[model samples]
Target: MIIVIVALGGGVAGGYALSYQQAQQSVLKTSVPKELAPVIAAYETVTNNYYKSVNTTKLTDGAIKGMLATLDDPYSVYLQNNDKTNLDDTISASFGGIGATIQQNHDSLSIASILPDTPAKKAGMQVGDVLLKVNGKDVSKQTVSKAVAKIRGKIGTTVAVTVKRGSKQATFSMKRQKITVDTVTGQLASANKQVGVITISTFSEPTVKQFKATVKKLRKEGAKSFVLDLRQNPGGMMSAALSISSMFSKNGQTVLQVEDRNGAKEVYKAGKKLDDGFKVTEKTAVLIDGNSASASEITAAALHQNSNIPLVGEKSFGKGTVQNVGEMGSNKELKLTIAKWLTPNGTWINHKGLTPDIKVDYPAAAKITLINATQLKPGDKGSDVKSLQQMLTALKVGSVTVNSQYDDATQAAVKTFQQANKLDATGTADQDTLATLAQKLSAQLTKDDPMMKAAVDAVAK
Candidate 1:
């Protein structure tokens, strides 16, 4: 009588929330354990005899969390309203918002990135602008999730956001729209135009469509081979993985296998229709890193086993369990592990990841620490300050000491960077300054990505 929401492209296929009748029926069919009589008595005693007022909602949520905590499983979680909404948005890959990703560091929430053609970009919202308020309500102390929930709303509605950039605060009122994330992006390799590199960040409903179009476009542009990069990809929809695998597999070929606790198994096969009437027969090499998991592993295993495609880069993140998300009333959700999944060869990669056919590690410099401070003054001292100093050194803004302490030399270097980037010449590294530094560092990393090089070399033959 347990409820389950089948994962369809990482999202629920029908209504998200369970109906009252369904919940009632499930509860009515199951008899409450007589062993819980003492637990119920404890609840009555606490509520009836407590000296101060109590929030029953918090009590109930805590009880639910405690129950889940006993399972000792990280995947099974009791999600609050905002957390549930965020997970749903991520799975669907679409949401009604200004289309900006936010990040929080040391109690400061700021814009991490902005999607192109979105209301946030149109309204001139720049990265690193520290969020101050939403709709005239102060949200400076709220968490990133709560603040984001405040920003997202029904499509066509307006949300006013106030952000602090440098020394001034600006408020922008913009209409929210449906922001569809592009999970798949492809481009012809600069070193070899005949080789196309496609990166799948995450799997979602639009992933298959986007992948099909990308393949078609690359082939039209004279790309004879492809490097499918799944590095840093935390897997999403199982449906997307199956559909994408079908593009390189024969019709009716096995893509994945699911087994429940009862030892019963379900076989998932590739469909010709899911291939969009075409087969990608070109030489393709998959690039996986330690972060690639679930759907990413499924696609990699399917292509490697079925088409004999070589896998390059490091081993994948092993995640072989399947989860079913059931929506509780009041915007809450219970995500529980339901079954285990196996690769095409019947290997369960629960904690042991797939070994790459060719392993290539990135350079040590690729592990550069990110700047996590909202601002850094001359007296500040931490790893973040050290990172800023290193970035300033790499950019050749000015000669500064690489020590963790932010001294006068660091301030001068920051000022020089600000002036060169056409920003306010503030000696302190502010949000805007930090964002610019991060972007510059990212560009350098992309140019020297060793994994990309290995992937291109593998498939460019």
Candidate 2:
């Protein structure tokens, strides 16, 4: 009787255990979708055996990350809650870092350009600098996201960076801080006192407002000519470029025309109102380089064809393709090329960039020089400086020394020349200054400097 009772007890306990296992299986079967049931069952079988012996049940974070890594798209990344918040701040154009525009080149990351006045620039970071390591870790195998995560930190904190510039490996200790990107730099040029020099880095939301204010201020200060510099601009918001271009053109003028693959065309036009308070009557010149692209090209094309603004410098970077950012589910986004743009004269500058009306190749020897000052030196005094100074004196400014020394006196005379001509106080002799100077010097000599002579002839026309 005692043996039989023990057998019955064992049977009851075994039956209870079987029932519990069936209940757990039923729950999982109901929870998993039909298509995923086989996968879930296989996972459960392995995990169950492991859990039965080890008593551990939670999934590892690394396992989750591994699943995300299987996706091939570079932009499709899995971010934790904390990382997601940081990324949002970065895309919103506000974050703390060394202030550089960076892009990934395969496994290697390269610096596109160092923002002016940022800690990166202050630390001597330059365009084309290749990042090698961060914080003592080898970043050669890391993704751009991983490298960026290691580089970014709280404002006022210091981070170490290793970069390869040509043959040398450079290490810099950079401080992290909030970087306010100065998109537009404006000043009055001494060469054409009547001309305002505006260099736009990128077209952002605030750019149009800033540009309008600068135009108004420059006109009040007596600027009658303009030189717009769009060199090395990678382009930005389309609306911003349109707004800025509108400031220079009359109403109903097309700034840019977009044509998609579906045969649909859209024309962006300028508003009738001029922002300079007065009419834009001055001759305008645009300077473009190989790095100017997209919206930068739009601005150049609009003013060039519509307003007949003469473009100087090299041909622009041919990137007239437009991209639209499409948001997929689960924070995944796609930036697909959607359309191509054309100039007002129906020129497609996709692979072939816009050719300058006046092409000026940067001298091979002058590649390292920062400023492009055109004034002649004391020893080389027969150039345009003496002629420009004389022209300035005629414009009611006091007589200049015209000694060809770029001394304090020369700079002062240039400033006075700029003031009389109603230009910004930048003492550099630019296209406008050279143009006006050529006109004054033409009376003294029959032979003309090629560029100055052209400018004088254009102004006369």
- How many clashing pairs does model 2 include? 7
Per-residue lDDT of model 2, residues 321-364, tens digit only: 77565453454344445788888877889878888898877433
Residue-pair clashes per candidate: 0, 7
lDDT of each: 0.76, 0.61
Query: 135-200, model 1: which lDDT tens digit per residue?
Result: 989988786678888999988998878888766565666778998687678889988999998887
Candidate 2 residue pairs in backbone clash:
188-424, 191-433, 192-433, 193-423, 194-224, 194-225, 195-225
Taking all chains together, the TM-score of candidate 2 against the true structure is: 0.55
Candidate of highest lDDT: 1
TM-score of each: 0.72, 0.55
